[model samples]
Target: MYQPRKRGYRKDNATLRWSLPDRVFFACGACHILAYAFLERWGTPGMQALWIRPAAGQTGNHVFVDGGDWVFDYHGYANRPQFLAHVWRGARRRWPGWDATLVPLPRDVLISEQKSRGYDGLWLREPGQFLHDAMPRANAYLDRFRAPAVRTAR
Candidate 1:
């Protein structure tokens, strides 16, 4: 069983303890960054980044790529229904007071948030160091599903 871990724990305290594979697939709590990487790697024009939140001004927001029929997250690609059910159930189990809802995430807003949070430049520049195994994990997950055809010509 994988549980999400708090971000920014100190190294001397042994806070960054998960194995590479576990950090990539289950924990790390950096879904917004990973979601953007996944979008860059496999997103079609029809797909967009979205945040799942309980409501306005709430914590525990989750980010993932949303294709019309499918979604890609730390768990990899899955049909929309299964993804929603999984998120809803998991969220409810984790936080009994909130209900999850999908919210649109404009690219600009995402970039701004990333920048404000001190991740914008660092993540891309030193992805392996900042987010070990993310790209490789994304590639492996993507291998399980055929890439969506480009919905529109560039």
Candidate 2:
């Protein structure tokens, strides 16, 4: 049985190990590659633009996304009900009118059916596709969230 971590646990440990330039470059490059791949699959973004950071002590601290009604888990896909009930209880309260039937990703239908007995989500054939699709929007959101850096002429 998998137990979720307590609420308000720190999902990320921000240590200033990498230089700002390094972090920015790495993030941009990664997002570019992902965006390219995602565009190849879905053509245009069809999912809702939301990012969900996994809880501490859960999977590798990877950021999840609400790809429309489905929660794109790196390991699998979580249905809307499951996502609301377990992962992020506040979502429903936040988006009251956002309602969509939870459907498994086409490729993961079989696996999802099996896992549905125990878990509230399913696995996708390529979960990255979903994540990549959501990246460009997420990147933009992150950019706005991060403060602009000040530079002085040498």
Candidate 3:
């Protein structure tokens, strides 16, 4: 299980040895790419990209793919209920007083948010490269679960 790093704790030990993409697994600034990658590859028409943000505090925004029955994030895959519980627990741990809400987002919204952050939008322009760089390390972790991740569109 990937443990969320404590806010402002910047000590690097074994994680330094991991590849840059691997290290970004559950780290900051990764949710967009990770979630986008999964949705692009495996998402069905019924699925939606969700943006989870706390109602208070400085908690960062999180994006994940929600397939009605299941959800996949940087942490891997889980049933909807299980994923919600996990996210709720993490939010409580990190921001004791805040309420976190999951909002369904469109692809354009995600791209706009990324644009606000000054991403050149390489992922949008070059999906092949984006998938090439991001999926391998993610799949390595996700493959541990009983449910296999989709590497390409069916």
lDDT for each candidate structure: 0.57, 0.32, 0.56
lDDT of 1 at 23: 40
Candidate 3 residues 1-154, lDDT tens each? 2344544433243243233445454444456555555655555677788867656444546778887777877656679898788778876776676566777766654544344344222222222233244445555555555543444657
Q: Give the least accurate 10-residue stretch of model 1, judged by summed lDDT.
A: 119-128
TM-scores, in order shown? 0.61, 0.26, 0.60
Could you give the candidate ranking by TM-score, starting with the highest? 1, 3, 2
Best by lDDT: 1
- In model 1, pairs of residues that clash are none
lDDT computed for candidate 2 = 0.32
**lDDT-based ranking:** 1, 3, 2
In candidate 3, residue 42 scores what lDDT?
58
lDDT tens string, model 1, 1-154? 1353546554233335333354444334456555666677776567898767555444455677888887877776789999788777776677686675676675444434344345222221223434354446545555666665555647
Q: What TM-score would you give candidate 2 relative to the actual structure?
A: 0.26
